[model samples]
Target chain A: MSIEVENIHKQFGSFTALNDVTLSIPSGELVALLGPSGSGKTTLLRIIAGLERADSGRILFNGEDTTEHHVRERKVGFVFQHYALFKHMTVFDNVAFGLNVRPRGTRPSKSEINAKVMDLLRLVQLEGLAQRYPAQLSGGQRQRIALARALAVEPQVLLLDEPFGALDAQVRAELRRWLRKLHDEIHVTSVFVTHDQEEALEVADRIVVMNKGRIEQAGTPDLVYDHPANPFVLNFLGNVNLFHGRLNQPGADQHGADENAVSYVRSHDIEIERSPQDSTALKAEIRHIQKLGPSVRVTLAIDATGEFIEAELTRDVFKNLGLQQSEQVYVRPRQVRVFVEDYQI
Target chain B: MSAPTTTYAAKANDNHRITEPALVRWGLTVVALVFLAMFLVLPLAAVFSQAFEKGLDVYLTALKEPDTLSSIKLTLITAAVAVPLNLVFGVMAAWAIAKFTFPGKNLLITLIDLPFSVSPVISGLIFVLLFGRQGWLGPWLDAHDTKIVFAVPGIILATIFVTFPFIARELIPLMEAQGRDEEEAALVLGASGLQTFFRVTLPNIKWGIIYGVILCNARAMGEFGAVSVVSGHIRGSTNTVPLHVEILYNEYNYTAAFAVASLLAFLALITLVVKTVAEWKVRQQLGR
Candidate 1:
């Protein structure tokens, strides 16, 4: 079901954890709460899961008020960073625990519970390890078992708190893809918390970038990547060479798309050459050169303004141009996106 | 063929070989072993020798007497009642101390360990002042026709008070070491607090609780001074094994007294075994 979080506020004594944070996820949508640590992403997730109550907020589940509901009554499943499986129980028992703890008057038959646990085990690809304890499972296997356990109750919403944060890089990547596939098959409305930008970019259908207890940007992957709402969103999302220069004109040549007139160019949009071509071109001194696989990242500083910029080129281009450190070079912007500058988004 | 080279290689191997520590450690270890044998082993040897020197038939006959049988039965029954009750209380108290930061928490912890610091004789006196025939609650209880002192209830109360902190103290460090992540995770998984306690919290603290209960039971079965003061030491009625041993000694029944004392000591030895096994099991589970 669709979930709506309206103007949520939370404070731990004097520390304001989340400040009037608000967002909505449609039914069957997979949203990622993307932010660095202490940015209120996990706090927001816990609020939605009903693990923590907000100082002021209204949460609606399919237009019904669920703010006062306890976590058990919320029908929301949660998977934690450490997996939180019962160490004394076997993998089978761990997965069956949620179903076994069903509310009064709704207890399932033993056979029904067994069948559901088996189905979940197979879904998580841990069918062969049903009798093994949580202590006997690897990090990735334990997390999968945790996921299976969370899904056992057939919850309406699933919340994952950095589910892959504890795994090694390779395992994190593998589980990230597996989670996306699982979400696609199940089509349950889900929200996952993560501080890793690559994970948020690759796994989620929509990304909500948070900073300092506020939403900096929220959109589809392409929308955020191609059109970040502000400097924080852009710098947090990916590598970008930022230029701070005033726009001289609004002509097509200057590539200023907005009237207010300052522009930011992507590192990939800056072209470096041996010869100057137009009035837009400026001479810069090469400060540093780094070879990255087939490309070379050349850091350049403009001579006139002493402003720094970075440009990426093919290794072949670097060889052809014969650029050296401290050598004079010509640089021009191939494309620029201009936006209205504001302190808040 | 290469005699000189082979000699050099042998010398190199000798230089690289690890040398064990010298004889000083071995001499100290032998001294320590002799000291342990003299101080710890000789007394136990004397107890066994004195108990059994009269032969099997005499020992069995002494053990089969109604007084001795009742004492053994009483100790077992009291421990059975006290251990499980302490186990439950211990876990709840440990959870409170380890997980929550509340007012009076430190005071509560200190109160829990009060029995350990106070003399068992003093402990019994405090209870006597509160529950004795002429004490504060004594008249009220007598008016209601209730009994607390000089009975089975008195023995149980004395045993419970003395052994109260054993299990909780053992579990506090363990629960603290595991931290709060798993419990919080269970809370988030739609498990109510009770369900979370049973499924998540209980399993982690199970070994520590077992170890603590074994120690408490061993101590409860052998407790003398407190139960003596509270129960008035009525023969075959309020006499636990330790109290029974004291009575036999007073009556010039030295052989039977040592025999019964040795039996209680055997139970204590078994408790040690159980505690060791519990620790090993905990380590095995942690290894996983």
Candidate 2:
């Protein structure tokens, strides 16, 4: 089901958690709410799930207004950070709970409930753990069981709040990949909250970057990475070499922006050459160079701008050039992304 | 001179040998054993030894008296009413205090703890001041022909007052420590508020609740001063076991009083067992 949150606002006492935040998830899209801690990403996801009420807004599901629906009436499945499994119940019983507690008119027979729970358990590859309580399972297994329990009710929208936040680094990566695969197979409209930028970039079809109870940016990972709407988005997405330089005409009008417009270039787009011959090239002395697995991060000072520039190079390219610290090099900007200072905020 | 020095050295060695770590540890254990024997074990032994001194038939005859039987029955009845009521109040208060923040929260918490700090005798006096014929609201109660003081209600009120904090005190910290995450998760999973409370919140706090119930019941059953003040210590009407024991002691009926006190002690022992089991279960669950 498609989910639409229109101008949602939430406040806890004097602190605003969400400020007129708006977003829409098309049916079957696995959108991610990504931000750092206290960034209001989780709050937004909770509002969507009806676990938290929005102070001012409306949430529509499949084009019908569900702003006043209770969380139980909203039919949104949720998986929590710590699994939040019912410690007293078996895996099968936990999964069958939603089905068994169906409202007045909708009742499932014993065999039907059992079949549905087993099917969900099988789907999560936890069929053998049906009789075991949640405490018996490992962290990853418990999370998978939490997922299966969320799915057992056949919810319209699946909401996960920092679903892998508590797991170890290795398990988190595996679960992210597995979740992506599962989302593809299930084709459920899912919204998952995460503070890890890498996890969001890797797992989400579209990422909503939040900051201080507001959306900083929202787009596909590539778009947000390559073309950040603001400095916050750029710094949040990944490492960047932000240079303060005025855009000079290449003797004529550039691709789009007028001359004298200030712009910045991404580290990957800056070409470092052995010779300082190009007219557009800027001369710099390397200060430090750290060898990453496939790429080398070179920190250098740009002579004209007196700004620190971070440059990235592939291992093969660095080896071929045989660069060293304190070595003078020329950097030519192949592509520059421009932003007017007045329009930044 | 050399002989004298050698003898002195030998005495020093003897002192050092006597002050070994093992010797110190044993000394400490002996001291603890003496204290336990004097205070706890000896007193209990005295109660049992004195009760059976008159033989089994004498104890049976004492128990057969209508006053003793009625006091036991009344005590049990009061406990039955007080324990469950305290349990409900404790859970509700814990839920409210641990789960929400509101105005007068600190004051409300202090009020919950008042029964623990106030003397049991004072607790009975407060009830008497409000419910006695010459006290506040006494006129209204008298006009309505309600006999709260010197009756079962008065006995229950005193028991309830002293035992009020036990269950809630056990549960509040536990519930606060567990937090609202599990309940919120249940809500998001479409569990109704009541279902979430029973299935998620209750299971997690069950041990705390049990621990609280045992403590409340123990206090409720053994309460003496407060119930005596409010129940008027009437022989057949409002006399509780503790009051009846006091009456027997005053009448020089030593064997019977000791017998009844022993019974109350046994009930307290049962409560202690329940508490130990609850603690063990909590420990085992946490260890896993």
Candidate 3:
């Protein structure tokens, strides 16, 4: 279902957990609420699920106002970060819980419940472990069972809070792909919260970056990564070489910099050369060289400001240039996004 | 030089061992066993021996007496009423304390534990002051011809007061540790409030409830000091098993008194067994 959160606000005693925030999510799209700890992403997700009440907000699910609905009436499926599976229940019973708890008049038949539970189990590829308890399964398997259990009710929307946050790296990678495939098959309007930028970029069709109780930026993964709306998004998304210097307007004398403007560039955007060829080049000394599988990382210390900057170069280029530690080099921005000191988005 | 050094190192390792020597360990074990025999085994053996001294016929006669039979029935009835009341109170108290945050929560918890720290006799006296004929509600109760103190109701009240904290004490920590995530999950899946409680919360805390109920039942059945103060010791009517034993003992009927006491001892043993089984079940549930 399409979700519209309009001007949501939440507070806990003296701390404001969420400010006036608004977001729109289209049906059948997977979106990730990405942020660091205490960034209010999880709070927003909970508000949408009706697990928490926003101090002032209106939530609409497919044009129906759901702000007054109780959690039980919302028909929103939620998967917790800790895989809050009932320990006393078998996998099959956990999946069958929603159907079994239906009011008597509209309840499904015994055979129908059994068939549906089995179908969910098969969908999660956990049919063989239906008799096992949650504690008996691995972390990844438990989360999968939790997902299946949430989907058993055929909810209009699915909400996951850090769905793979507790798993190790390898398992997390595998589950990310599996979750993408599952979304393709079912196409339920899904929102998941995550602190891992890589996981968010890899798994979500659209990413909403949050910071300090506000939405910093929201766009497709590539858009948010390449064209961040502000410094917060740029620094949060990936590594960048921050240069504190005045910006010179196009066609302006290179030596006469505008003292008010400062700029930063991504590590890959900064180019390195053995000799200074132009007035734009800034001389620096190479301090450290790291040879990662296909790329070389060169750490440079600028002579003018004594600031260190990193430049990523391919292994072939590093070898052709004959770069060495403690060697002098000139650096210039091949492509950079410059922001003035008082810049605002 | 290497051989001699190795031997010396081994000797030092033996001297530096953390555990006591074998002889000291055996001595401590013997001491523990002696202590148990003196305190536990002796009392248990004496009860049985004294009860059977005049032979099985007298033992049977004592048990068959009308007053003894009536006392047994009274004790059972009191336990039946008191235990279930306390069980419901405990569940409600635990649910409120574990699952909700509000003002005066700590104070409420402290008040729930009030009965535990207060002496049983004092608890009975508190009720007596409240409901006794010469006490605060005495005039009103007397005018209505309703007797609470020195009656079966008084005995039940005292028993309940002593057993009030058992179930809540058992449940609060367990429920608090389990948290509200599972219940929230159930609600989000379209389960009603009652359904979430019965299907999700109850199953997770089943062992804790069983553990609490067993302890509550034991206390309700075996309480003596509190029940004695309120029961008034009226023969065949108000005297519980413990008070009945006291009356028999005062009349110099040692065998009869010990016989009745032995029945209570047997009840204690059963409670111990049930408690052990419940604890084992809790461990098994948690271990999984």
DockQ (0 to 1) for model 2: 0.50
Clashing pairs in 2: none
Candidate 2 Cα errors over 4 Å, as ranges? A247-345, B1-38, B101-103, B284-288
Q: How would the docking of model 3 be graded? A: medium
Alpha carbon lDDT at A204, candidate 1: 95
Local distance difference test scores for all models:
0.86, 0.86, 0.89
Cα RMSD for candidate 2?
7.5
lDDT of 3 by residue, B1-288 (tens): 799999999998988697788899999999999999999999999999999999999999999999999999999999999989998999989999998888999998999999999999999898889899778998999999999899999999999989999999998988898888888888888888888888888887788888898888878877888898888899999988888999999999999999998998888788788889988887776666
Segments of candidate 1 deviating more than 4 angstroms? A103-115, A240-345, B1-20, B24-28, B31-39, B61-67, B97-103, B142-147, B177-195, B247-253
lDDT of 1 by residue, B1-288 (tens): 699999999997787575445586688889999999999898888888989989988788888889899988888888988888888888899999998878999999999999999999987887788889989999998999888888788788888999999999998888887778778767666678988888788888888888998999988998887888888888887789999999999999988998898898788779989999999977765555
**Chain A of model 2, TM-score against the native?**
0.90
Provide TM-scores for the models: 0.84, 0.88, 0.90
Residue-by-residue lDDT tens digits, candidate 3, A230-326: 7778778877876777533253213223564557677887889878777888999999999999999999999999999999999888999999999
Q: RMSD of candidate 3 to the true fold?
A: 4.5
TM-score of 2: 0.88
Clashing pairs in 1: none
Supply the global lDDT for candidate 1.
0.86
Q: TM-score-based ranking, best first?
A: 3, 2, 1
